[model samples]
Target chain A: MTERADCRASTVSYAAGMLREQLLSPTPVDLRAFLMRALRPRDCLVQVGGLAEVSYHGRAASTAEVGSYLVMIKRDGSLQIHTPKGVKPMNWQPKTDEITAVLEEEQCVLLASRRSPVELVRVTFLEVQMAQALELNEEAGFLLTGSEAQMQETLAAHPELIEPGLRVLNRELLVESGGIDLYAQDAQGRFVVVELKRGRATQDAVSQLGRYVASVQRVVGTGVVRGILAAPSITGPARKELEGRGLEFVEVNALPLVEKRTSQPSLF
Target chain B: MTERADCRASTVSYAAGMLREQLLSPTPVDLRAFLMRALRPRDCLVQVGGLAEVSYHGRAASTAEVGSYLVMIKRDGSLQIHTPKGVKPMNWQPKTDEITAVLEEEQCVLLASRRSPVELVRVTFLEVQMAQALELNEEAGFLLTGSEAQMQETLAAHPELIEPGLRVLNRELLVESGGIDLYAQDAQGRFVVVELKRGRATQDAVSQLGRYVASVQRVVGTGVVRGILAAPSITGPARKELEGRGLEFVEVNALPLVEKRTSQPSLF
Candidate 1:
């Protein structure tokens, strides 16, 4: 049965990525066929539940006794086995050189290995209860944000918090297209353009900062201006965009100062 | 597409044990009813998949951004969230005093708390994909074994390997019913009765040793005979049985000496 306690909350996450890759058929023939396909090298994540026996044969050898477990093969060529008892996987191997699966008799056998030092591991699945293979895309499909107006004000009050030896020169300074969040000067006397987001930032925010910096550069010369985007976190694509343009990212967790007396209380 | 490699084998396990535990029905009403059941305190293991936003509100206040994850609540009042990318749980709390689930506006809210330091974790599940809860029974329903006969020879040649100063007096020494694996004398010079098992030892093996020790005790007039069970592993019931009978368990991994040149090769 169960016990009762006050319903407090804890840290948790949700799933959103689309299931674009393989959906498992849960048979050795299907697994062999899937694994024997061309080596396209797309990101892959596989989960299978069954009886497994894992053994490694390299410089040092070790084997785990057989038991039912959830085996995961990640896209980065890493493998892990999760038991029912705890959070940590009962066994795991780091990213490696190669991973292959095949059918022998009615059983599914997986072989993973690394070169140079020559390490190898084999996993045998006696019976599969559930199996799924997913391909992960590095793109974040959703965005979470807070009040940008309040975020700019907070960082305006504490420019040094954004970067040491920085001071705000203007807030909402008008340019040709729109108003910049905060125009500032860096410690090295460089004109620094700052854009702040209360929550997760995206490529649109980065592009805005880049335009602001370009505007300042037109007046102060190209090499005299710097661009920085400050936010609690940023999406993967936004990070890539910032890196490509040689811009900087500063963390600003204080933007969400107002937890919105709006919105209903959370359910679990 | 999948790549090809030589299909070697690794350590794996299979599932057993009757589904004596609870089988879950996914619904707020059902979860509330199940969680509000009597405090029977049977071992519980739960697995739920969905979008979740986890936040901890205690001395160290923290919150994880919303994402998809697997949430696990274990029998001992422990809770964990597993992400898809790695072997470690993204977030976890140790054994706690209470864990409760309730529905608010169709959202499932979980509150888990510990008393001493007064730490609490709150998890809100916006949607549920796959959810199941099963009671974990410690009794292992199956067994694994090795070469018992070979194990006896390995230990006989190296009795000190079992315990320091242990010397074998005889192999398969006869008793009232049958033969003991190894008859030895300890560093203390008391008579020792040893039972050998190649793979996993069970309650039956422990009982056999108990009988042997009693036999030797009757012949030697009590308090002078010690019983030992040697095997690669032992079942949970056998472990409890050994402890209750005041017996010893020794490591004997040499059993499955012949990996059965029989049986077809593994499938995954």
Candidate 2:
């Protein structure tokens, strides 16, 4: 199902379970009010793209050269302004910064400021190609886990779950390129390099394992060295690459049930 | 200093310490090779926007409707496809997934796949508005410290750092609306609500602290309750908001030097 709305200054469309409002013209618009209305439920993403000129005044005054810019505002009021290309934004208002939006007839401006050290970013939109607000479901309690370490610890305690006679040699073995998750040996006495992922394994993991396997094989000789990718699941492309490279994949769950059980004293 | 290069199919320009490569034509171009070359050092961001139609065929076969799409590729091979207004990507390849780019006469395609689950995402560029690659500096050894928690611990250990006679009553005090980082009593015996940030405090933090202060004030009576925002630094906007609302700002460093000193064994 799809729903769409159009105002004098913008077009709002909903399709494929997403609500999007796009402003195409250079008309004067109340950006803050528009954002408040569009970002209903307070957890959407606001993206502004166009030519921008930024100036900072107070501690010291400086003007940034005009350029095409992309500004992303998170639901938490944190926002960043990025130039055409780069990993980091040229200027940013971290999540803790206060943001105020000012809309005028000629242009729209966003002010992000903090007082003690006196930092402020004044973003002036010269021409706004697009100002869009996308509705997103609030993700609940997305906890960050120390998964790789947890997986290694789990496997070390329960090596048999991986395969019979598989023995863990060491954890986090540093190689020239990167660190190997686990160094191990199988029942056949052949050296094995194990790569663990806390979640579903992807093609990059396969490639990484492949590189480590190649490096280890060079030192251990091709016939005696083997590689294994350990994760809860593997993607199709990753599995294809694994089998094609003569490597193996094992599903390893990283629940700390053993640790929990060991930490609790038995009532008996 | 700035530099620029242009080919029949694309134009590359550098200005304001940023390198920008853009392809404006409707004609087919080898986007993969262009990306591989432009993203030299392999740690840049690739953003493709305009119109996109994606098809997935492998374990499950489905085709996405043609629409304006934004595709972001990170340095670590993670990519996400977003419609103009969604917080989550319509399709995504996690960082662990392997990505391959293929350029054809009619279209430029990117394939992200995983082997075990037999998953694949084939993104076909129907119309390219803008394709850009920007250079970024390599960040070295970025450490993640639990700064907020550390700050709370530090202040609890050394309340004198914040102000004389400031006694921490409790940590993570739950209020009606939000949790106050620290609940304390000032030297004047006023109920002080503290909000702590490990890094620079922004305007949002001030707003949040205001909310907490208001909630606590209702119970303690307005004149008796006070708000204090503590962080490593404060931005101008945040400070302005702090002053406007009659709140206090305090700088707190979270190096854990005190904890380190106490944890060490005596050399004597």
**Model 2: residues with Cα > 4 Å off, grouped in runs:** A1-70, A73-109, A112-268, B1-12, B15-19, B30-33, B55-63, B94-98, B113-120, B136-151, B154-268
- Model 2 chain A lDDT-worst window of ten: A1-10
Model 1 Cα lDDT, one tens digit per residue, B157-202 = 9887688899899998787635788999999998899998765787
What's the lDDT for candidate 1?
A: 0.64
The DockQ values of the predictions, listed in order, are: 0.03, 0.01
| Candidate number with greatest TM-score | 1
Error of 2 at B228 (Å): 24
List the lowest-lDDT window of 10 residues for candidate 1 chain A.
A2-11
* Candidate 1, residue A125: lDDT: 75
RMSD of 2: 21.9
The candidate scoring highest on lDDT is 2
Report the poorest 10 consecutive residues by lDDT, candidate 2 chain B. Answer: B1-10
Judged by DockQ cut-offs, the docking class of candidate 1 is incorrect
- Which parts of model 1 have CA positions greater than 4 angstroms off? A1-27, A31-45, A57-61, A115-119, A134-268, B1-44, B57-61, B75-77, B134-268
